[model samples]
Target: MQPLLSSYSSSSSLTIFLVSLLLVGDHGGARIILPANVTVPAVIAFGDSIMDQGANNNLNTLAKANFAPYGKDSVAGIPTGRFSNNRTPADMLVEQMGIKEFMPAYLDPSLDDKELLTGVSFASAGSGFDPQTPNLLGVLSFADQLDQFKEYIEKLKGIVGEERTQYILTNSLFLVVAGSNDLANTYFTIGIRKLQYDIPSYSNLMVSSASNFIKDIYKLGARRIVVFNAPPVGCLPLQRTLSGNEHRMCAEKHNKAAQLYNNKLQAELKHLHNTLAESKIVNIDIYKPLLAIMKNPKQYGLEVVDRGCCGTGNIEVAILCNRLLPTCLDASKYLFWDSFHPTEKGYNILMNEVVGRHASDWF
Candidate 1:
């Protein structure tokens, strides 16, 4: 399949046409067809708000997004705790894999046995590889999420026989998206980690934690894994509003920190891929593609790049972006739903490229 974005240009008419095409259905762009060699029976996810489906809804944390204007564009037209205006990347990934239309959150009480077999997201909105990141926000830590995965495994074994459960686990596509919160929130915005370690050392800590998480899951039976690198956190609307100059340019320092972590993470994943037995661990580069769209929004048929579609688009996110505030008339024109998360259309664009370019590597 060809890439969604094969070239970049500034033609207004072309941008308008592409934007129209992107807003066609629940998710835009051409559908992804898996290769004959691949067999993704399930698509499991773990990480922060980027991959969070609704795991934060019941948590007593400000990271929740189960209210208003959050799911205005959803099929049901009600908030589902996703950080986006509609479906999240987790949901999109499952759909792209042809396993299911939506991936349920592991914490959602309504999940049935069928959904469990398809896969679920254990991600919390404010979570990071850093244990303290979720502790500070009262959301599920990586350890807590891992514990939830263990519980899920037991439940799956109860539903299906041990052999089938193992088959499902071994064939499922495991997506690990994290480290953004560690750099953007814990280290830079919160400034707590700065007191402990500088950029390189903290990157090491994140890499080590991520490595352990991968190994832990590998031991549990996961073989086909995709580890997403940190996005350009500096370009996020929240970062720009906080650290950008009067013009609110992308925060170069924050981007640098994210790049540092991504480089370390790529190297670590490479090492793990070589060492792990019968494992296919690949690092997906979210930073470059996202930065490309941010640098030239029109290339992706998006208008607002520096800000988001909700409220002032500068600092509002999670609880701050609520029903009381008016959202943009057309969120499809915007790249972000809130200060910290992408809109459904933006995620579709990104996922289209991701599944097209890298989905085959897992096999």
Candidate 2:
């Protein structure tokens, strides 16, 4: 399979491809099901709330989304700390790969030894690559997450022995989705970082932190790692509402910072690829596609792009987006479910872009 849609460019072509892949069945008159021929043995996730399945629920943090309307359209129809109204990119990616239904939160006490073999997410809500970002928000730091990953490896070794564990570690797909919080929450916010460093310097610090995290994971036996660059932070509903003034325009300054960080991150990943033998450190640009979606909402069947589906969508997120506030009846019409996060429908579009971009790498 030399990538299913290597030549397709238009959205109509993409839609046709999707139906053929997801809906069409075999000629035997039964639903055509295939075995999961996943390239990796497992998919480990480490990042911020964008990839946080339900890790924050176990932590003593103010950033939590394990409540009603959050999981309004999830597989179980129950909130599991995902910021979206339904399944996230993490959920969609693994399923499309035919690996598993959903990646469970690593901190979930109910996770058994067997489940550890597939994979679990270590991402926490409000976390950032910056050490102080998580600390400031009272969430798990990236450093802490890495330590947890180390411990997870040890536990896996105990369960399946060292040989199998090594194989799993080397073959697993490590997903790193962070840095948005560092720029959007910590640096841009009226905090110590703003007083200490300029946008360029702060972005450099983020790149350094992210680069170190990648190197550490590589040393820990990760081989296939996909690091998602930060999305357009300025376009986020919260940022727009905060700085958009009365007209509610996007904060271009924040978007520029996001681009700066992404450029640096891509350069760092390329350097890692050249230096770290057997390590596949890939950089995925999410901002471009996401920006297109926001710019042309009609192209993606969306109506509300300036606000979120959860309450006002201006500033509410995590705990602030509570059950007391009524949610949008049609989440599909909105790009964001909350102030900063995309709705499940929005995430679905993102997943399509990811798969289209990285299908060759996965296959």
Candidate 3:
């Protein structure tokens, strides 16, 4: 096989093209032989819609997007409840690591023992660290996701036996991406937490919740864990729409809140890494990259930064972004695919940056 690096002009382009290939199949695309060395045995994802592969499809949640126009650029050309046109960050990271091109949803009925051996995503759409977040959408909470993970381990035990399951759990890469919904959707939109706690107090709650989650998973034999910081939710199309003014911009207050929470979360992660035995808890700063894209769309080959590709691009998402609604002709030009989610192209760019800048140090 030809070297993928030589074939592509840049890493970002390589990542984007490779993700498309992964989604559809090689389809006569470059087939670069991945290095024999595997970084992590598997990548187990836990979070909200950002990482959800299709877990919400099986649930009676209103946050589902398993229909047409959602996966317009995907290989299957059908919605897979991924919250993107194609694969997500989870899929990109897993594929980039040579674990698998596609990580199946743990809740999918067709999930087999073979797929479980490599990896599977346990994330659910509309989930968050705060219980109220999921409660609002009738989706899984952080605790509920943890419970599902526990159930997954039991199932793994049955498939690969106790010892192998333990080995996989200890060696695999555990990705936790929460809090975005907690702040953006739950606290801000619903105002339930605002009535009880102030911004600082609420951010502290998010940090505490994240710490508990990391510690719990560490106790469960997870050694390599990557937790994502909340992005600039204020920059999301929905939030911008809520700004009301015709000349709306990224909400500064919300962005500031995200930065504060991220600072606290990073400090907590560093402390956890120092304390946890044999654990490598790493923090992935999602805010900076995402914010950069929003600031300079041309820098990332994106034309539209303020709105999404689906329908009105301001507030429509999930159920509202149906097949009947007109979507952008080329999703690649748009930074966001929906009101709250990044486009598949945007995810590819993020994945490339993340793997290039961060993964080398950890792996």
**Model 3 misses residue 26 by how many Å?**
14
Task: Give the top-scoring candidate (lDDT).
Answer: 1
Cα lDDT tens digits for candidate 1, 1-363: 012123324463243221111000127555557777767788889888877888888877667789998999998889998888998888877776677888889999899999999999998877888877777678888899899999999999999979999999999989898888888878887777898899999999999999999999999999988999988887887777667776778889988998999999999999999999999999999888888888788988899987889988876677767899899999999998888888999998888877778876877
TM-scores for all candidates: the values are 0.92, 0.88, 0.89
Once fitted onto the true fold, the runs of candidate 3 whose alpha carbons sit more than 4 angstroms away are 1-39
**Candidate 2 stretches greater than 4 Å from native:** 1-38
C-alpha lDDT of residue 168 in model 3: 95
lDDT of 1 at 350: 84
Which ranges of candidate 1 are over 4 A from the true structure? 1-26
The local lDDT score (0 to 100) that residue 240 gets in candidate 3 is 71
List lDDT for all candidates, in order: 0.82, 0.78, 0.77
TM-score of 2: 0.88
Per residue, candidate 2 scores C-alpha lDDT tens digits across 259-287 of: 99999999999999889998878888889
